[model samples]
Target: MLNDFSPAAAASSFSPAFSPPEVSQPAPPTFTSPAAAVAAAARLAPRLFEQAARTDEVGGFPTQEFAWLRETGLLTAALAPALGGAGLGEPAAALALLQVLYHVGRGNLAVGRLFEGHVNALLLIQRFGKPAQVAAYAADARAGHLFGVWNTENPAHGVRLNFLAGGTYRLHGAKTFASGAGHITRPLLTGALPAHHGWQMLVLPADEQPPQLDRSFWRPLGMRATASFIASLERLEISADCLLGQPNDYYQQPWFGGGAA
Candidate 1:
């Protein structure tokens, strides 16, 4: 858990130098099938295991591991097949994704945990985002941009969204246990809307400055590389399009039911 919604004073900050994400990565490989994607992940697992020892410290991240994932194209494998991916999340192909996760986790849980977030965020956008939204993010994935989901928040002061003028929503409060805090360029965040409006799901803009990270809140017994930290996005304003689906749509079918199944 990310601790409480009440702000924690002890924290540290990490900002990815590559944001607005000008990552220099190779083009993704063409995946022939979900089976091929699984094979690729299986093969890469041990290599990540070898690196796990390196990223096991406080604030460690599987940077090289993810770069390798980008090079191999598993980063984009969850997209629809028509998008030059393996369609890993569809019912017929979902098992392949699970197998990949199993292997990665067997090798290193931190990397597996982060990779799962990347895959699940893509699935959520593909399932709930509009066509233009989907196309734009797919392009980012192909370009090696990592994604994450941040839903946990402070219990006493969970993140909130205040609708504002000109199709904007101002953020309030913080999200705790926010994984990939500084590393992920795109994070799908959940914030409470006005009482009658339910919750809102929104993806922060890729270029938005990194949210404030309180380093003190992150001292897990393990998976420290996951960088699950307290993030306060209070007062950040986002355009309407950043909103993913209707109020409370994040809890809907498929994903809410656990898309991995």
Candidate 2:
């Protein structure tokens, strides 16, 4: 059965450990309707296409394309209306996201993939994160933080999180094929936990503690602009706030299988 990922379901599953965000979010841009959101992306298609060819090099990223996306406010459009977005990822506007992805892919597939990852990351947070985590990440989206989801890793050197005292974690290992490596500031990463705790999802601020980026690890036949690289996060210390949801929430039910679909 499909997961009941509605707002009510999300709140019902929240843990007592998490509290709502104290800082009130500033008023977001007047809610962009789904049509308007898609239209804005459509307007930028040609420009994205024009730049795609130039960025097809090793470690290349669509920086200008993302700038235009931020300028057009598409980055935050995945959030719900209450959070100052167009509700693109909500159940009601599901088709709108597909249409937006289609248009974006028509121009540049790599950008489309990265955009999908961004939207999916936000969607997951809304569905699985605590109220505070959701609100904070939504604010980041509105503030033009480029978000990404990094899950893949080498089998032998996979990302691992060692629990420490006082809700802190000591990370060891790295993530491979991490898209938009250097450019993605807020990356939602998954790491294996010790003592059979399953995997944990973390909202990493790569900009603050930059990972060891190895571009040589990514040798794609095409879509070179993805900039997927190996990012070693060895010894990175993170607080409890970085945790997105409970342990193993990432692979839970329809949310996990459904996301893959």
Candidate 3:
């Protein structure tokens, strides 16, 4: 029930301004300062939870709540302290996200689900992206960019990877159940490569026009607000940098289920 991809509705631009990220932790255990961040979430919990959950039930993204998240330090929880973020690691950040989810769930499941995608997308950028990629995503997020995932393909099968003449590969077929389809500023997408043997991750700038929704139908009973939509790939251009890692890099990570589930 969503509209086709429209470039105009996408974000014009995004950039996050903050100090450089500290290189000390490829992945840290505890937050640089847990108490402070948690305390902050506690204070803003009432408002944040109410807004995100409400919008989820209404079948829309909580734009205002996301803005508040950016204003607050919650959205940048995983970025290093040096980068003007809470610098919380996976575990700590997970805890904070869970708190948000709990509040959202109390209000509505759709909101909690979408929020999880945003958090997971942010976490992936923080964990695997190159320095510049990290900095860019962090900057955009701080500057109010929304992120999500778009991996679920048709119930029949997922996207396929076709071996190309070069070392590169091509993605054929389509993906369904793309949540945050129109609202996200960036989305973590997934597909497979025939040469590789498993799935791969790719970060697409949602600032471009949103993808067109397929008329094909398979509506579920509940979770209507998810806005799960369909999209096709016909010779979409992607470079080596577009690739996240070897096959299955996305699903292999321990934090794969960090916020989504």
The prediction achieving the highest lDDT against the true structure is: 1
Would you give me the overall lDDT of model 3? 0.59
Each prediction's TM-score versus the true structure: 0.92, 0.85, 0.71
**Which lDDT tens digits does candidate 3 get at residues 25-130?**
2322223474565665566667754554355443444566555555555666656666656655546455665665565445446655666677678777777788
Off by over 4 Å in 1: 1-14, 17-25, 259-261
| Local accuracy of candidate 2 as per-residue lDDT tens digits, 1-261 | 012112122112111111122345343354459988888888889888888888787757777777667667788888888988888877778788888878888888888888878888998899888999999888877766778899987767788999898889888887877887777778899998898788899999766766766666666755878877677787888888998888889998877876676
RMSD in Å for all candidates: 2.4, 10.5, 7.2
lDDT minimum window of 10 residues, candidate 2: 10-19
- Which clashing pairs does model 3 show? 5-210, 5-211, 5-212, 7-209, 15-139, 16-139, 16-140, 199-248
Error of 3 at 191 (Å): 0.4
Q: What is the lDDT of residue 182 in candidate 3?
A: 54
Cα lDDT of all candidates, in order?
Answer: 0.81, 0.76, 0.59
The full ranking of all candidates by TM-score, starting with the best, is 1, 2, 3
Best by TM-score: 1
Clash totals in order: 7, 0, 8
